[model samples]
Target: MNWHGLKAIYLHEMDRMRRTLFQSLVSPFISTSLYFVVFGSAIGSRITEIEGISYGSFIVPGMIMLTVLTQSISNASFGIFFPKFTNTVYELLAAPLSTFEIILGFVGAAATKSLIIGTVIILTAGIFVDLHIEHPFIMMFFLVLTCVTFSLFGFLIGIWADNFEKLQVIPILVITPLVFLGGSFYSINMLPEFWQKISLLNPVLYLVSGFRWSFYEIADVSILTSLITILFFLSACVLTIIYAFSKGYKIKN
Candidate 1:
Protein backbone atom coordinates (compact mmCIF):
# COMPACT_ATOMS: atom_id res chain seq x y z
CA MET A 1 0.00 0.00 0.00
CA ASN A 2 3.05 2.23 0.37
CA TRP A 3 1.71 3.81 3.53
CA HIS A 4 4.92 5.82 4.00
CA GLY A 5 4.78 7.21 0.49
CA LEU A 6 1.11 8.03 0.85
CA LYS A 7 1.74 9.77 4.15
CA ALA A 8 4.58 11.78 2.71
CA ILE A 9 2.55 13.01 -0.24
CA TYR A 10 -0.45 13.71 1.96
CA LEU A 11 1.65 15.77 4.34
CA HIS A 12 3.21 17.63 1.44
CA GLU A 13 -0.18 18.70 0.08
CA MET A 14 -1.41 19.65 3.56
CA ASP A 15 1.77 21.64 4.13
CA ARG A 16 1.24 23.46 0.88
CA MET A 17 -2.27 24.40 2.02
CA ARG A 18 -0.90 25.72 5.27
CA ARG A 19 1.72 27.74 3.41
CA THR A 20 -0.96 29.46 1.31
CA LEU A 21 -3.56 29.56 4.03
CA PHE A 22 -5.15 32.83 2.95
CA GLN A 23 -5.58 32.03 -0.70
CA SER A 24 -6.42 28.41 -0.05
CA LEU A 25 -8.76 28.92 2.88
CA VAL A 26 -9.52 32.47 3.95
CA SER A 27 -10.35 33.80 0.51
CA PRO A 28 -13.37 31.54 0.09
CA PHE A 29 -14.50 32.29 3.61
CA ILE A 30 -14.45 36.00 2.95
CA SER A 31 -16.26 35.65 -0.35
CA THR A 32 -19.02 33.51 1.12
CA SER A 33 -19.44 35.94 4.01
CA LEU A 34 -20.13 38.65 1.48
CA TYR A 35 -22.84 36.54 -0.10
CA PHE A 36 -24.60 36.54 3.23
CA VAL A 37 -24.13 40.24 3.70
CA VAL A 38 -25.13 41.44 0.25
CA PHE A 39 -27.60 38.76 -0.69
CA GLY A 40 -29.18 38.60 2.74
CA SER A 41 -29.58 42.33 2.98
CA ALA A 42 -30.71 42.80 -0.60
CA ILE A 43 -32.52 39.63 -1.58
CA GLY A 44 -33.68 38.80 1.87
CA SER A 45 -35.78 41.93 1.69
CA ARG A 46 -37.66 40.80 -1.38
CA ILE A 47 -37.81 37.16 -0.35
CA THR A 48 -38.51 36.86 3.33
CA GLU A 49 -38.54 33.04 3.41
CA ILE A 50 -38.61 29.96 1.28
CA GLU A 51 -40.70 27.08 2.58
CA GLY A 52 -40.78 28.85 5.94
CA ILE A 53 -36.96 28.88 6.25
CA SER A 54 -35.57 32.38 6.45
CA TYR A 55 -33.90 33.70 3.34
CA GLY A 56 -30.48 33.68 4.94
CA SER A 57 -30.97 30.29 6.57
CA PHE A 58 -32.44 28.88 3.40
CA ILE A 59 -29.36 29.77 1.45
CA VAL A 60 -26.96 28.40 4.04
CA PRO A 61 -26.81 24.89 2.62
CA GLY A 62 -26.49 26.21 -0.89
CA MET A 63 -23.79 28.66 0.21
CA ILE A 64 -21.80 25.87 1.83
CA MET A 65 -22.23 23.60 -1.18
CA LEU A 66 -21.15 26.38 -3.51
CA THR A 67 -17.96 27.00 -1.55
CA VAL A 68 -17.22 23.33 -0.98
CA LEU A 69 -17.73 22.44 -4.64
CA THR A 70 -15.51 25.18 -6.04
CA GLN A 71 -12.92 24.90 -3.30
CA SER A 72 -12.66 21.12 -3.66
CA ILE A 73 -11.91 21.42 -7.34
CA SER A 74 -9.50 24.32 -6.84
CA ASN A 75 -7.63 22.68 -3.99
CA ALA A 76 -7.30 19.28 -5.67
CA SER A 77 -6.67 20.64 -9.14
CA PHE A 78 -3.93 23.02 -7.97
CA GLY A 79 -2.42 20.43 -5.66
CA ILE A 80 -1.57 18.12 -8.54
CA PHE A 81 -1.31 20.75 -11.27
CA PHE A 82 1.54 22.56 -9.50
CA PRO A 83 3.59 19.39 -9.43
CA LYS A 84 3.00 18.86 -13.11
CA PHE A 85 3.75 22.50 -13.88
CA THR A 86 7.06 22.22 -12.02
CA ASN A 87 7.96 18.89 -13.67
CA THR A 88 7.97 17.28 -10.23
CA VAL A 89 5.28 14.81 -11.20
CA TYR A 90 7.82 12.60 -12.86
CA GLU A 91 9.58 12.30 -9.53
CA LEU A 92 6.28 11.40 -7.94
CA LEU A 93 5.68 8.80 -10.65
CA ALA A 94 9.10 7.32 -9.90
CA ALA A 95 8.52 7.20 -6.16
CA PRO A 96 7.51 3.96 -4.41
CA LEU A 97 3.85 4.89 -4.55
CA SER A 98 1.08 2.98 -6.30
CA THR A 99 -1.58 4.89 -8.23
CA PHE A 100 -4.13 4.23 -5.50
CA GLU A 101 -1.82 5.64 -2.83
CA ILE A 102 -1.09 8.72 -4.88
CA ILE A 103 -4.75 9.41 -5.55
CA LEU A 104 -5.76 8.79 -1.94
CA GLY A 105 -3.14 11.16 -0.65
CA PHE A 106 -3.98 14.05 -2.98
CA VAL A 107 -7.74 13.60 -3.18
CA GLY A 108 -8.06 12.82 0.52
CA ALA A 109 -6.27 15.99 1.46
CA ALA A 110 -8.43 18.01 -0.90
CA ALA A 111 -11.60 16.55 0.55
CA THR A 112 -10.36 17.24 4.06
CA LYS A 113 -9.76 20.87 3.26
CA SER A 114 -13.19 21.26 1.70
CA LEU A 115 -14.81 19.56 4.66
CA ILE A 116 -13.08 21.91 7.08
CA ILE A 117 -14.20 24.86 5.02
CA GLY A 118 -17.74 23.51 4.91
CA THR A 119 -17.87 23.24 8.71
CA VAL A 120 -16.48 26.69 9.13
CA ILE A 121 -18.98 28.11 6.68
CA ILE A 122 -21.78 26.42 8.57
CA LEU A 123 -20.64 27.93 11.85
CA THR A 124 -20.21 31.27 10.17
CA ALA A 125 -23.71 31.07 8.73
CA GLY A 126 -25.10 30.39 12.19
CA ILE A 127 -24.08 33.88 13.28
CA PHE A 128 -26.22 35.41 10.52
CA VAL A 129 -29.40 33.39 10.82
CA ASP A 130 -31.03 30.64 12.82
CA LEU A 131 -29.44 27.37 11.82
CA HIS A 132 -30.60 23.92 12.72
CA ILE A 133 -30.04 20.44 11.36
CA GLU A 134 -33.06 18.21 11.37
CA HIS A 135 -30.92 15.35 10.11
CA PRO A 136 -27.34 15.82 11.23
CA PHE A 137 -26.20 12.39 10.02
CA ILE A 138 -27.65 12.91 6.57
CA MET A 139 -26.21 16.41 6.44
CA MET A 140 -22.75 15.03 7.21
CA PHE A 141 -23.11 12.17 4.76
CA PHE A 142 -23.97 14.53 1.93
CA LEU A 143 -21.13 16.85 2.94
CA VAL A 144 -18.53 14.05 2.95
CA LEU A 145 -19.82 12.54 -0.27
CA THR A 146 -19.82 15.90 -2.01
CA CYS A 147 -16.27 16.67 -0.91
CA VAL A 148 -14.84 13.28 -1.90
CA THR A 149 -16.72 13.07 -5.17
CA PHE A 150 -15.73 16.56 -6.27
CA SER A 151 -12.19 16.00 -5.11
CA LEU A 152 -11.97 13.08 -7.49
CA PHE A 153 -13.49 15.18 -10.25
CA GLY A 154 -10.87 17.82 -9.48
CA PHE A 155 -8.14 15.20 -9.66
CA LEU A 156 -9.19 14.53 -13.22
CA ILE A 157 -9.09 18.26 -13.95
CA GLY A 158 -5.60 18.39 -12.49
CA ILE A 159 -4.46 15.58 -14.76
CA TRP A 160 -6.23 16.87 -17.88
CA ALA A 161 -4.82 20.36 -17.54
CA ASP A 162 -1.47 20.96 -19.30
CA ASN A 163 -1.31 24.65 -18.40
CA PHE A 164 -2.42 27.03 -15.64
CA GLU A 165 -5.30 28.77 -17.46
CA LYS A 166 -6.95 25.46 -18.23
CA LEU A 167 -7.36 24.97 -14.50
CA GLN A 168 -9.82 27.90 -14.19
CA VAL A 169 -11.87 27.06 -17.24
CA ILE A 170 -14.28 24.54 -15.78
CA PRO A 171 -14.66 25.99 -12.29
CA ILE A 172 -15.35 29.45 -13.62
CA LEU A 173 -17.18 28.91 -16.88
CA VAL A 174 -19.00 25.74 -15.94
CA ILE A 175 -19.16 24.93 -12.19
CA THR A 176 -19.88 28.37 -10.78
CA PRO A 177 -22.72 29.01 -13.17
CA LEU A 178 -24.19 25.61 -12.52
CA VAL A 179 -24.27 26.34 -8.78
CA PHE A 180 -25.88 29.78 -9.14
CA LEU A 181 -28.46 28.41 -11.52
CA GLY A 182 -28.94 25.16 -9.67
CA GLY A 183 -31.24 26.20 -6.85
CA SER A 184 -28.39 27.35 -4.67
CA PHE A 185 -29.69 30.80 -3.95
CA TYR A 186 -33.38 30.15 -4.58
CA SER A 187 -35.68 27.17 -4.50
CA ILE A 188 -36.52 25.58 -7.81
CA ASN A 189 -40.17 25.88 -6.91
CA MET A 190 -39.99 29.61 -7.39
CA LEU A 191 -39.36 29.06 -11.07
CA PRO A 192 -42.10 28.58 -13.60
CA GLU A 193 -43.30 25.02 -14.01
CA PHE A 194 -41.41 24.59 -17.26
CA TRP A 195 -38.23 26.08 -15.84
CA GLN A 196 -38.55 23.92 -12.77
CA LYS A 197 -38.36 20.90 -15.03
CA ILE A 198 -35.36 22.38 -16.76
CA SER A 199 -33.67 22.99 -13.44
CA LEU A 200 -33.85 19.26 -12.77
CA LEU A 201 -31.36 18.69 -15.57
CA ASN A 202 -28.71 20.77 -13.86
CA PRO A 203 -26.66 18.24 -11.82
CA VAL A 204 -25.94 20.61 -8.95
CA LEU A 205 -29.67 20.95 -8.27
CA TYR A 206 -29.85 17.45 -6.91
CA LEU A 207 -26.91 18.11 -4.62
CA VAL A 208 -28.20 21.42 -3.30
CA SER A 209 -31.70 19.99 -3.07
CA GLY A 210 -30.74 17.04 -0.90
CA PHE A 211 -28.34 19.11 1.15
CA ARG A 212 -31.04 21.69 1.84
CA TRP A 213 -33.38 18.83 2.62
CA SER A 214 -31.16 17.75 5.47
CA PHE A 215 -31.57 21.14 7.04
CA TYR A 216 -35.32 21.76 6.59
CA GLU A 217 -36.63 18.46 5.21
CA ILE A 218 -37.69 20.13 1.98
CA ALA A 219 -36.16 19.46 -1.41
CA ASP A 220 -36.73 20.14 -5.06
CA VAL A 221 -36.30 16.44 -5.76
CA SER A 222 -36.44 13.25 -3.80
CA ILE A 223 -33.52 12.60 -1.49
CA LEU A 224 -33.04 9.22 -3.13
CA THR A 225 -32.48 10.93 -6.48
CA SER A 226 -29.83 13.21 -5.01
CA LEU A 227 -28.02 10.27 -3.41
CA ILE A 228 -28.05 8.39 -6.69
CA THR A 229 -26.85 11.44 -8.62
CA ILE A 230 -23.76 11.94 -6.44
CA LEU A 231 -22.93 8.23 -6.40
CA PHE A 232 -23.24 8.06 -10.16
CA PHE A 233 -21.01 11.09 -10.56
CA LEU A 234 -18.48 9.57 -8.19
CA SER A 235 -18.39 6.34 -10.18
CA ALA A 236 -17.98 8.19 -13.45
CA CYS A 237 -15.07 10.23 -12.10
CA VAL A 238 -13.37 7.04 -10.91
CA LEU A 239 -13.70 5.39 -14.28
CA THR A 240 -12.45 8.49 -16.09
CA ILE A 241 -9.44 8.66 -13.80
CA ILE A 242 -8.58 5.03 -14.48
CA TYR A 243 -8.76 5.63 -18.21
CA ALA A 244 -6.68 8.81 -17.97
CA PHE A 245 -3.93 7.07 -16.06
CA SER A 246 -3.97 4.14 -18.48
CA LYS A 247 -3.53 6.47 -21.46
CA GLY A 248 -1.05 8.63 -19.56
CA TYR A 249 -3.11 11.71 -20.33
CA LYS A 250 -1.10 14.82 -19.48
CA ILE A 251 0.97 12.72 -17.07
CA LYS A 252 3.47 10.45 -18.80
CA ASN A 253 4.41 13.01 -21.42
Candidate 2:
Protein backbone atom coordinates (compact mmCIF):
# COMPACT_ATOMS: atom_id res chain seq x y z
CA MET A 1 0.00 0.00 0.00
CA ASN A 2 1.23 3.51 -0.79
CA TRP A 3 0.63 5.48 2.40
CA HIS A 4 1.34 8.78 0.65
CA GLY A 5 -1.20 8.14 -2.09
CA LEU A 6 -3.84 7.16 0.47
CA LYS A 7 -3.13 10.32 2.44
CA ALA A 8 -3.35 12.43 -0.68
CA ILE A 9 -6.77 11.08 -1.63
CA TYR A 10 -8.05 11.27 1.93
CA LEU A 11 -6.91 14.84 2.33
CA HIS A 12 -8.35 15.84 -1.04
CA GLU A 13 -11.76 14.39 -0.16
CA MET A 14 -11.70 16.02 3.26
CA ASP A 15 -10.89 19.39 1.71
CA ARG A 16 -13.75 19.03 -0.76
CA MET A 17 -16.14 18.47 2.13
CA ARG A 18 -14.66 21.43 4.01
CA ARG A 19 -15.32 23.64 1.00
CA THR A 20 -19.05 22.81 1.22
CA LEU A 21 -19.15 22.46 4.97
CA PHE A 22 -22.33 24.49 5.24
CA GLN A 23 -24.39 22.26 2.99
CA SER A 24 -22.70 19.09 4.17
CA LEU A 25 -22.87 19.87 7.90
CA VAL A 26 -25.54 22.41 8.81
CA SER A 27 -28.13 21.10 6.38
CA PRO A 28 -28.18 17.57 7.85
CA PHE A 29 -28.43 18.91 11.39
CA ILE A 30 -31.37 21.13 10.40
CA SER A 31 -33.08 18.34 8.52
CA THR A 32 -32.76 15.96 11.48
CA SER A 33 -34.27 18.63 13.71
CA LEU A 34 -37.28 18.87 11.43
CA TYR A 35 -37.80 15.12 11.69
CA PHE A 36 -37.82 15.43 15.46
CA VAL A 37 -40.33 18.25 15.25
CA VAL A 38 -42.71 16.73 12.72
CA PHE A 39 -42.45 13.06 13.65
CA GLY A 40 -41.15 13.28 17.21
CA SER A 41 -43.61 15.94 18.34
CA ALA A 42 -46.64 15.87 16.09
CA ILE A 43 -46.90 12.18 15.31
CA GLY A 44 -45.20 11.03 18.48
CA SER A 45 -47.84 12.73 20.58
CA ARG A 46 -50.56 10.65 18.98
CA ILE A 47 -48.74 7.37 19.57
CA THR A 48 -48.09 5.98 23.01
CA GLU A 49 -44.72 4.91 24.27
CA ILE A 50 -43.29 1.58 23.12
CA GLU A 51 -41.79 -0.72 25.74
CA GLY A 52 -42.14 2.01 28.41
CA ILE A 53 -40.07 4.61 26.56
CA SER A 54 -41.77 7.77 25.30
CA TYR A 55 -42.71 7.86 21.64
CA GLY A 56 -40.36 10.72 20.85
CA SER A 57 -37.46 9.12 22.64
CA PHE A 58 -38.17 5.78 21.02
CA ILE A 59 -37.52 7.14 17.54
CA VAL A 60 -34.33 9.06 18.31
CA PRO A 61 -32.02 6.24 17.34
CA GLY A 62 -33.96 5.58 14.16
CA MET A 63 -33.81 9.26 13.28
CA ILE A 64 -30.09 9.34 13.94
CA MET A 65 -29.59 6.14 11.97
CA LEU A 66 -31.60 7.55 9.09
CA THR A 67 -29.36 10.61 8.81
CA VAL A 68 -26.19 8.56 9.14
CA LEU A 69 -27.30 6.09 6.47
CA THR A 70 -28.36 8.71 3.92
CA GLN A 71 -25.41 11.06 4.42
CA SER A 72 -22.83 8.28 4.34
CA ILE A 73 -24.30 6.92 1.10
CA SER A 74 -24.42 10.35 -0.52
CA ASN A 75 -20.94 11.36 0.57
CA ALA A 76 -19.20 8.15 -0.51
CA SER A 77 -21.18 7.78 -3.73
CA PHE A 78 -20.39 11.32 -4.84
CA GLY A 79 -16.77 11.05 -3.74
CA ILE A 80 -16.06 8.31 -6.27
CA PHE A 81 -18.73 9.12 -8.86
CA PHE A 82 -17.48 12.65 -9.52
CA PRO A 83 -13.92 11.42 -10.05
CA LYS A 84 -15.15 8.75 -12.47
CA PHE A 85 -17.45 11.16 -14.33
CA THR A 86 -14.70 13.69 -14.92
CA ASN A 87 -12.11 11.06 -15.87
CA THR A 88 -9.98 11.82 -12.79
CA VAL A 89 -10.35 8.18 -11.80
CA TYR A 90 -7.81 7.28 -14.47
CA GLU A 91 -5.20 9.08 -12.41
CA LEU A 92 -6.25 7.14 -9.33
CA LEU A 93 -6.16 3.87 -11.24
CA ALA A 94 -2.61 4.59 -12.30
CA ALA A 95 -1.53 5.58 -8.78
CA PRO A 96 0.58 3.34 -6.53
CA LEU A 97 -2.32 2.62 -4.19
CA SER A 98 -3.97 -0.80 -4.05
CA THR A 99 -7.70 -1.24 -4.44
CA PHE A 100 -8.10 -1.63 -0.67
CA GLU A 101 -6.21 1.60 -0.15
CA ILE A 102 -8.43 3.41 -2.61
CA ILE A 103 -11.55 2.10 -0.93
CA LEU A 104 -10.27 3.05 2.50
CA GLY A 105 -9.37 6.61 1.53
CA PHE A 106 -12.76 7.50 0.04
CA VAL A 107 -14.89 5.34 2.34
CA GLY A 108 -13.07 6.53 5.44
CA ALA A 109 -13.73 10.15 4.54
CA ALA A 110 -17.39 9.42 3.90
CA ALA A 111 -17.74 7.59 7.22
CA THR A 112 -16.06 10.49 9.00
CA LYS A 113 -18.58 12.95 7.57
CA SER A 114 -21.46 10.70 8.56
CA LEU A 115 -20.03 10.19 12.04
CA ILE A 116 -19.69 13.92 12.60
CA ILE A 117 -23.16 14.60 11.23
CA GLY A 118 -24.62 11.80 13.33
CA THR A 119 -23.01 13.10 16.52
CA VAL A 120 -24.32 16.58 15.79
CA ILE A 121 -27.80 15.18 15.19
CA ILE A 122 -27.71 13.37 18.54
CA LEU A 123 -26.74 16.58 20.32
CA THR A 124 -29.43 18.49 18.43
CA ALA A 125 -32.05 15.95 19.53
CA GLY A 126 -31.18 16.82 23.11
CA ILE A 127 -32.31 20.43 22.63
CA PHE A 128 -35.81 19.36 21.64
CA VAL A 129 -36.12 16.33 23.95
CA ASP A 130 -34.28 15.01 26.93
CA LEU A 131 -31.99 12.12 25.92
CA HIS A 132 -30.36 9.40 27.95
CA ILE A 133 -27.85 6.72 27.15
CA GLU A 134 -28.35 3.43 28.90
CA HIS A 135 -25.18 2.04 27.40
CA PRO A 136 -22.81 4.71 26.18
CA PHE A 137 -20.19 2.28 24.89
CA ILE A 138 -22.69 0.28 22.88
CA MET A 139 -24.17 3.45 21.46
CA MET A 140 -20.80 4.66 20.23
CA PHE A 141 -19.89 1.21 18.91
CA PHE A 142 -23.01 0.87 16.80
CA LEU A 143 -22.71 4.48 15.63
CA VAL A 144 -19.26 3.85 14.19
CA LEU A 145 -20.21 0.47 12.77
CA THR A 146 -23.31 1.88 11.10
CA CYS A 147 -21.24 4.64 9.49
CA VAL A 148 -18.60 2.25 8.15
CA THR A 149 -21.06 -0.25 6.72
CA PHE A 150 -23.19 2.35 4.98
CA SER A 151 -20.12 4.10 3.60
CA LEU A 152 -18.97 0.87 1.96
CA PHE A 153 -22.42 0.29 0.56
CA GLY A 154 -22.23 3.80 -0.84
CA PHE A 155 -18.88 2.99 -2.43
CA LEU A 156 -20.50 0.02 -4.16
CA ILE A 157 -23.31 2.23 -5.45
CA GLY A 158 -20.80 4.73 -6.80
CA ILE A 159 -19.10 1.99 -8.79
CA TRP A 160 -22.36 0.56 -10.10
CA ALA A 161 -23.93 3.85 -11.18
CA ASP A 162 -23.10 5.40 -14.56
CA ASN A 163 -24.97 8.71 -14.19
CA PHE A 164 -26.13 11.23 -11.58
CA GLU A 165 -29.76 10.11 -11.76
CA LYS A 166 -28.73 6.47 -11.48
CA LEU A 167 -26.56 7.35 -8.48
CA GLN A 168 -29.56 8.54 -6.47
CA VAL A 169 -31.88 5.68 -7.36
CA ILE A 170 -30.55 3.38 -4.65
CA PRO A 171 -30.77 5.79 -1.75
CA ILE A 172 -33.99 7.54 -2.72
CA LEU A 173 -35.94 4.69 -4.23
CA VAL A 174 -34.57 1.68 -2.38
CA ILE A 175 -32.99 2.70 0.95
CA THR A 176 -35.59 5.32 1.85
CA PRO A 177 -38.57 2.99 1.55
CA LEU A 178 -36.77 0.20 3.38
CA VAL A 179 -35.98 2.60 6.24
CA PHE A 180 -39.52 3.92 6.62
CA LEU A 181 -40.99 0.44 6.58
CA GLY A 182 -38.26 -0.92 8.80
CA GLY A 183 -40.06 -0.10 12.02
CA SER A 184 -38.42 3.31 12.39
CA PHE A 185 -41.56 4.92 13.79
CA TYR A 186 -43.17 1.84 15.28
CA SER A 187 -42.09 -1.48 16.70
CA ILE A 188 -42.53 -4.71 14.78
CA ASN A 189 -44.60 -5.98 17.67
CA MET A 190 -47.19 -3.37 16.80
CA LEU A 191 -47.63 -4.88 13.38
CA PRO A 192 -49.87 -7.79 12.48
CA GLU A 193 -48.30 -11.27 12.35
CA PHE A 194 -48.01 -11.18 8.56
CA TRP A 195 -46.44 -7.73 8.37
CA GLN A 196 -44.20 -8.43 11.35
CA LYS A 197 -42.75 -11.40 9.51
CA ILE A 198 -42.18 -9.20 6.46
CA SER A 199 -40.55 -6.42 8.52
CA LEU A 200 -37.88 -8.82 9.68
CA LEU A 201 -36.61 -8.98 6.11
CA ASN A 202 -35.70 -5.28 6.06
CA PRO A 203 -32.07 -4.97 7.17
CA VAL A 204 -32.54 -1.42 8.46
CA LEU A 205 -34.75 -2.79 11.23
CA TYR A 206 -31.80 -4.53 12.81
CA LEU A 207 -29.72 -1.36 12.76
CA VAL A 208 -32.45 0.78 14.29
CA SER A 209 -33.30 -1.86 16.86
CA GLY A 210 -29.66 -2.30 17.78
CA PHE A 211 -29.12 1.47 18.09
CA ARG A 212 -32.32 1.89 20.09
CA TRP A 213 -31.13 -0.85 22.40
CA SER A 214 -28.02 1.14 23.13
CA PHE A 215 -30.17 4.05 24.27
CA TYR A 216 -32.94 2.29 26.19
CA GLU A 217 -31.22 -0.96 27.16
CA ILE A 218 -33.96 -2.69 25.19
CA ALA A 219 -34.67 -3.64 21.60
CA ASP A 220 -37.25 -5.41 19.50
CA VAL A 221 -34.48 -7.78 18.39
CA SER A 222 -31.61 -9.16 20.40
CA ILE A 223 -28.46 -7.02 20.46
CA LEU A 224 -26.31 -10.07 19.67
CA THR A 225 -28.39 -10.81 16.60
CA SER A 226 -28.20 -7.20 15.49
CA LEU A 227 -24.42 -7.19 15.88
CA ILE A 228 -24.11 -10.35 13.83
CA THR A 229 -26.38 -8.96 11.13
CA ILE A 230 -24.29 -5.79 10.89
CA LEU A 231 -21.10 -7.80 10.63
CA PHE A 232 -22.57 -10.04 7.98
CA PHE A 233 -23.66 -7.07 5.87
CA LEU A 234 -20.31 -5.35 6.24
CA SER A 235 -18.43 -8.48 5.24
CA ALA A 236 -20.70 -9.01 2.25
CA CYS A 237 -20.18 -5.45 1.02
CA VAL A 238 -16.40 -5.73 1.33
CA LEU A 239 -16.34 -8.98 -0.60
CA THR A 240 -18.50 -7.52 -3.37
CA ILE A 241 -16.20 -4.54 -3.74
CA ILE A 242 -13.13 -6.78 -3.79
CA TYR A 243 -14.65 -8.90 -6.53
CA ALA A 244 -15.60 -5.82 -8.50
CA PHE A 245 -12.10 -4.40 -8.28
CA SER A 246 -10.50 -7.75 -9.16
CA LYS A 247 -12.76 -8.16 -12.19
CA GLY A 248 -12.28 -4.52 -13.20
CA TYR A 249 -16.03 -4.10 -13.36
CA LYS A 250 -17.03 -0.46 -13.86
CA ILE A 251 -13.66 0.75 -12.55
CA LYS A 252 -11.47 -0.63 -15.37
CA ASN A 253 -13.88 -0.20 -18.23
lDDT of each: 0.92, 0.91
TM-score of each: 0.97, 0.98
Where in model 2 is the C-alpha error above 4 Å?
none
The 10-residue segment of model 2 with minimum total lDDT is 24-33
Cα error of candidate 1 at position 252, Å? 1.2
Error of 1 at 26 (Å): 2.9
- Cα lDDT tens digits, model 2, 174-207, are 9999888887788999999999999899999999
lDDT of 1 by residue, 1-253 (tens): 8888999988999898798878866776687789988888788988998999889899999999999999899989998999999988988888988777888999999999999899889888887887999999999999999999999999999998988899999999999999999999999889999999899999999999999999999999999999999999999998898888878788985
lDDT of 2 at 122: 89
Model 2 Cα displacement at 252 (Å)? 1.0
Predicted structure with the largest lDDT when compared to the true one: 1
Off by over 4 Å in 1: none
